[model samples]
Target: MAAAGPGSAEGTTGQSALAAHLAFRSAIGDVSGSTRRLSGELSRLEASTPGIAGRASGLFVRYVDHGVLQLRWMDAELAAATQLANAASEVKDPDMQLALLRRAGPRLQAAMMGSLLLAVWLDFLHLTDVALKQHIYSVEWLFVDLDRVQKMLKPAMTALSSGESGQVEAVARDIPALVGHLTREFAATREAMRAGAEKLQKILVLKESIEAITLLSALKFSLPSLPPSAPALLGMSLTVGGDGVMMGTRLVVSAEWVEMMRHLVRAGVLSLPTVSAAVRIQAGQVMMAQSHDELPKGVCDALGDGPEVQGMHVTGRAGAGMNEPPRHHILPKEFREWFEKRGFTGEMDIDQFCVKMEQANHEAIHGGGNWKLGRTWPGEWNRMILEALQKAETRTGRMLTRNEILDIVAERMEEYYIPLKFIPWRGP
Candidate 1:
């Protein structure tokens, strides 16, 4: 066969690039539709069963909104890539055409990163759906049992008042049995719900980690080699403009991403193995182990006294051969007056609303990190919690109850990838 000229090769490469772009755009559209549908479903679930559904439904909706924003950015980049590809095709000089196509490489890579992020998010949504459904079922069953017990109570009281010995005796026996059954069921359901919530939190951390990786990848922070078990790059050719520049399919592990992952691993957000396993889970190549129920060591260390206020201790007390993490005020101490005005008064000592945390995690939350993250994530979390509190008070037209405030704190912690165990426990 005669050798293909540069012009002919350029034309063929451009065509393949266009085809890949179109396929990716189609995939984005599909994911966008799915995200919108899931958001709507979650909204409905949140509205209908606000009490039982808790915050997961609403949190997912917010997550979907964030994902959609990412998709919009992706679409813009893809459009740019398509335009550049077309421009390359119109150029007569092979060198000029090649240069134009080369310019599209980064754009295409960005779009690909967005696609990967959306795919991971969609997997998270599926997992959230399952967990939320289970939670709803468990709470609903508890309500049903409560109603049944209430009905039984009235008749039992009547038999006792009427002095019907045999009836009272039988009724007493049945009541104890029912109460015992209810207790056991409630404990089981409560434990299941807790586990589900913890699972969702860990998965949320994984999702955020993947998002960070994708962003880093788009910024060209990647190794020439791929990571272990990394999936194929959707069978798309990354080479463009007749130059052998590989723009995609490399493992993205920027120094910043690596540092953040190291911090997370050390802080017990998720273990290193869990991170790898979770990625595989998103790729549909593996399942999470059921036996992984214990809180991360960092979390356990933070929850030292088990979320209870067992009297006040020194903020950063270290024991022999042990480094004690510093205690962080869940509601910042500087905002103690503000929280008190919003009903942290009386028995609600803001000082008691604290959790132990590794120094790095604590510093990060307080805006001590990379300038970009410090400006955004930490500030965003603070704003979110404050806004949530303000909105709740506005809706109820009153200061939040103690439990209500605790619930808000807990929800925000989960949303921001903080350990739920950090919230002060107030009994079951």
Candidate 2:
């Protein structure tokens, strides 16, 4: 009989996550290796201009940062998997294994998604390098490949996390097919870049050739995975024309490109804590471009001052629904400290707690938005605050006096709502 592979996933979630992590680490190793090598080569090469050199150096920094992050995540996943495997060795019960697997479902999903995206990003970097060296604009075609890979894997990611053994197996069976497609597409992209570079070299004038190099430098700053509509996100079909020699360099930003960027930020891929700081800073640039004046007349006409064009600076959607809460939330450090100080030793599920806070904020605004510090707390607001405090105390074996609870609620409101002057009500 053949030896079982890590992907066999015949056991529980921990086993499945371990299997997925190992497989992804192995698969991503090649891409990571290439990026490491190229980054070194780029660092050593002396660019013709300081500008070009700066851009090359920037790409190298990103290459190093991304590689480090990928390895860190892989190591953490391995540690978790190994620890679980050891514990599972002692527990003979199948039910216990299943429970462990369920516990691991989230990490497994993240491992698979992160690995697949990293591979795609590495290929994108390689393509960008070739485009600069050859002065041919063939990198756009690679987005089609990236788009296909993202679409293919997203469904698998969903299924693996669904907690059904059969579904996970079904998804696992598709990995080889997925890998095959990615390999084929990347191979095709490299070949195209090589051929395009060779052919373009023959016909390019000196100025146009130099322009290609410059364009490549600009492209390096565009992380293939950062934007929402990034080819890695949903896939992209970009049109390219006008070599700097024949035409005045046309790089048309399409509607799809704009939409992709929105998707990327909204999805929180750009907001990974390690990367979110830089991406969020640039996020305003993206949002600013969507403003009525900056957008194309056609897009502006279609949107007509709509929220899509206006953009939501604040985090939530308008109106009420169980699903209307923000998609992502990070707890304020002060609030966490207050909780800890009160002896709440429970797992701090920031996301769930943020939802409750948001709902409370929403109600406060709805209740005439009359929330002011040192004033009588609204009935509904008081009820929600007490419930949250009681739940936390129950979970953590901590007790908070009524006054303490009120103080916490007051502090929370001051930070989250007072600045906005939560009074939505205005006299006519």
Candidate 3:
């Protein structure tokens, strides 16, 4: 039943990797597949940056690190996109599926956004490298680049945070143009540096100090005249595979909705970080909406009057829960089987499991203590809750409260960027 999503093994049949790649490209409307190409380029750049050293190398290093983080965030968002796709796939309602995909639009847009910053960073680094090589490094130029980058960063962040897919997509689409401009400039500079280095070779003299300043070993400037240990720099190295590979391998999502379903099979393979609790919570809400009307009487009986769906939002809507018939707590056999499948083989009956979960949740929220899952593995708790919901849906033919699902999943929300673990600027 759940095999309908993009990543499901059932869909892997006779389709070639190239065909699958094309299918995915079209489903998300990314015709150029620019983001994936950029990701591969960034991977190459990341490998080449470490040995570079000059007056502004520290800043360049930070840029590389920041690029990596952005990619990591993109990877996290990809997982979320997959989940959104999968949830949409599992349901029978077209309207609901569209709603889920619409919600997914912003995240998909955000996933391709890392390259924008990477491009800006590359431009700044190239300029700085040129200044250092030409012995014209200036402090004012540093701040100018910083200002320009920061200005661009704000809008990019806004796009990332926004749910407006069209807006985000526009921002992402503009990246390739900037990449083209910077790439041409980069090629010109590299050539000039190479020619200049060849001229200097005749009169070259190795010296420890350029003037009054004693050159430190760590501050060696990468000269353009020298053969690159690696191939080309970031901009010039963006060339993808051979012509045939590029032609046969072009990603194109079909116009048909059936093709879209084929691309969603592998959704939700990536694990979300603690900071993505909101996404998880939101997903839970969406899932609940799907099963709400179809919930079985027996499953309702199991949860009792106050089912206490974890992560469920508290609303003041009049007669929300009050109008419903009194709920009774009873563990059904199907619920037991579901837990067993998840490796919850202890003697704790269904009622005991519910009580423990509710009690742990109560203590965390109301006990004025450090809020944690109070379990050895918080992930286990989350898995149980989602699994239980799935079981309930199967037994009762209805979705449960997704907000409450968040209550369980939201047990541990972490910051997306931890200051202490970030760039060297954060300090050890």
Candidate 4:
């Protein structure tokens, strides 16, 4: 067989590199599509259950935003690499072709690492989605358990307080068994939530590890060669082969990276903050119920006697306290005409729909004083609510009912993290 010429050799190398590049690009595309789908699913889940999916929603927002930047950078680098590879394929000179291919190596490696980081990110998203759903289901069951226990206890306590001997004797006997059942169910649910949190923590650690690797790879591609002193500055080895060949390049994690990881692990950085918040909220609810039960009957009755303002039983006089904030209309009074045209024509006076909030928070909602809430603030929220109303009307080709409008308002309020208590009470 005739010996292969320089052209033939260049053709083989270029073809191989180009094929690899195409495969990596294809993988990136597949992963990108998966991320988008997963993100949409997470968003819908959040929409359905606002505060329940807070942790997962926060992570998705943060990482997806970061991923966008990384992917863009990777795409640009890979495209440049492909161009270099193509250039090498056309050139007949052996040394020039090698130089071009060498230059392309770092870009390819950086892009490859970026793609892997995204794959890890995709796994994180999937795990978070599963974990969030499980937690929500478990928490819902816990609430059910609490409700059942409360229902069982209330009548027994009432019987005891009212001095009804027969009713007391009847319920007292069942109390022990009921308490035992609640204890078992609550313990099991707590265990499940704990396990789910641990899983999330593990995935969070894995994500960080991959991020570190990706960052080091990027440094390698950008710097190509680091002096001996560079290790101290970057806290990682950034050396490559003398001939500029990136194949078989070894990256040594610096002491700093290991120590930083240790610190984060020790600090419980991997623990989901939102999960902890949910647990605290649940605990607070139980405490609140207990406190309410402990209140004197007269006080309980008095609580209900507070003057009704905008459908809320205002327990405290508006001007009784220092620096009392005035009540603000939920739907801005200025927009009353606009809202009436769409569906605010219910029996309840539009002006009376108000919620008492802090002066700063109230002002922030109305686009006052350095409002920096981005797309979720007064401006975007206003647009969103109006659009929702418009869409609802268009779909039915009729104005919305009072309840329907309130439902829309509630959803938007939750979406923007406004307190749900601010929504005017619907009559029983």
Candidate 5:
């Protein structure tokens, strides 16, 4: 979950921290293990960007925040990577394990750090316009370095196999050290990334940190004086020693997803803002005040229907959700830049666009407001899109050209930009 996707424009530091962890994870493994603690994370998201399924800050921040779960996810991934690396070290074929270790480990370390840095930059909400490019470059370097080292290991392995086990042992001694060397290089990248991020975070005056317990500070828990602070929204499970004092460690514990849900409900009480959250405090007093249950309507609306992941698309296709790849195109500029500038030029796949449009409409048409488990977050998200488009349409205060709006939105989605729902800039 790249922080730039959609939703959180604020892109909390929590998001940055998580992205750092996720960056590490992508090289290591899947994000689901960290998802084990979603209940608490979801509650935090709701508190920060309520009704995101309805009206979100922006796509970038939304994804950034959604990525906080990735930090915890890193706990599991770090554990797995460390274990695998350790096992590879112990193998009788030290040469074989060393090869695997060198090939995959360094790149994983490098790319993950790069991601973490990007997340930090995003959370600060600087020129994502810049980060868009920087992120790709930094991560690209990660893979480049990784592939280089992995490729080197092949020849090294070939040489070792021609010798005795003592030679293999000699090479094995260097395995961890070589991997550590890569790790050191990754750390340097991480530092450079941090500098870039520090530069980025400097650009914005962010809102107060929203916590699951504090919800939103504006939406106070009580009628009058709201709690002054957004206490740390405790992780659903207080602790899990996933990494076990090696590689790196962080708290990640497993709990029933349902239990996690209950944690959100309780934490929700604390999360209420001084104003609107105050309304919920009164319970029945403020029907206008959106309640926890009321949170569902907009959420249901957003998760309407679509594939969860999507790929990059240089060529514009209006309805493509993420998982799909960018249609083949060789433009002078990247699709992201063209998109940020409110321009789209090059060959687009119209047939695929029509199919995606039909699919999106069908989901909106048939699925109506059906939400699966843990998907409450997406409903308001879709509403954010629908409403933003509707709002953008209304704001122009004229009979706008349909083709124009569609073109802008199609570009926005293509670049994986943020919560503008649709595009904010109306082309001339």
Candidate 6:
């Protein structure tokens, strides 16, 4: 599995998150390895440039400081998962503990994806300078491969459940090898950075600036064992040409790339419907119903994530209905720390908690975008990203501090997602 952060979940979500966090941490570990290597290489690449180091100082900082956070977030996730897993081992219930462990895979996958996209955004805007891009491309090209192996996990899991341990082991073994490459490449990158003593001249007389928009295309494979749209949900696609050596001297991101991107937007938007919000709303309604009386098997199957639903149970004890005031209303200090995340106090209070949680549940398992992001984007994620860029004055050589960068990432996340929501959990 690729590295991921805690993903779109926090607190004691459940058993699956345990595995997810493990996978997530693994991915983040790679991010660190890659970032360190890239930095070392960039340092070498700029060694001979007369003014480039000072010119690109802020860019380098962004790559290093910002990149390191990916690893930290992964650590946070692993910590959270470890806590949950340990707690789960104490549950003493045979079936339930195993079920919890099983859920870890999906959560782990979601976390890995969120980290990748975050990396993409960071790299895309890091420093559009050529050597920097080359350094980034060479190192990050590996991050993209995490998806290939993770995709296989589902098939392996399906096979494992249906009596195919050999297949599961085959895929599981592939994960470490792929992940190790990320580490090994970074070590090599570090060496490359140290070894390169000469710098190339800036010869742009023959090359033009890259095209702004390029098309990224991908191939879709449908498998019968998983959900019908699973492949599409996993975001498998090929990034075809939009680049080439125009005069054997310069590279270009062409108009053709823009057209391809446009096609993707058209196809994706037309073919797929946004399901996260709907799922949350539906799940919330079911929880409300179940709290009232006996929930049907179908409803239980859909909304029976006993762990997430138990937040109310944590505060008010199990069997407490929406109408009842919570008996134990202690929101974690961390939860209360978010600037916009106000404490729970019972205005639809627990009434809507289940709905808020429902979205995350679907996102983790079915590969929904809401949960995949890992960041709780407010309504202004895009605006914040631009604002950060502007504040950095990256083009002008000014840069934000580490706190400022994290603030931007946080604020941008808000713009990317929905209103504040909650789900309390207790796990191993």
Instruction: Please name the candidate that would achieve the greatest TM-score relative to the true structure.
Output: 3
TM values, all candidates: 0.27, 0.29, 0.36, 0.25, 0.20, 0.26
Give residue 56's error in model 6 in angstroms.
5.6
TM-score of 5: 0.20
Candidate ordering by TM-score (highest first): 3, 2, 1, 6, 4, 5
Q: lDDT per residue, candidate 1, 257-367, as tens digits?
A: 333333333322223332222222222211111112221232222223233312222122131113546656677665677788766653245653556678788667756
- lDDT for each candidate structure: 0.42, 0.37, 0.36, 0.41, 0.30, 0.30
Residue-level lDDT of model 4, residues 92-193, one tens digit each, is 443334434444443443443334334333333333344344453344444454345445444534433332222323333333333333334433443454
Candidate 5 C-alpha lDDT tens digits along 6-98: 345424423433333333333344323323334344444444433222232334444434345334434443454455444333333322233
Residue 88 lDDT in model 2? 30
**RMSD to native for every prediction?**
26.0, 18.5, 19.3, 28.1, 27.0, 24.2
Tell me how far the alpha carbon of residue 328 in candidate 5 is from the true structure, in angstroms, after superposition: 31
The candidate with the higher lDDT, 1 or 6, is 1
Model 4 bad stretches (over 4 Å): 1-60, 136-428
lDDT (tens digit, per residue) of candidate 3 on 37-87: 545645654554332243344455565455556666666666665665555
Q: Supply candidate 2's per-residue lDDT for 337.
A: 59
Q: By lDDT, rank the candidates, best first.
A: 1, 4, 2, 3, 5, 6
**What are the runs in model 5 whose C-alpha is more than 4 Å off?**
1-43, 50-62, 65-83, 93-97, 125-428
Candidate 6 — worst ten consecutive residues by lDDT sum? 214-223
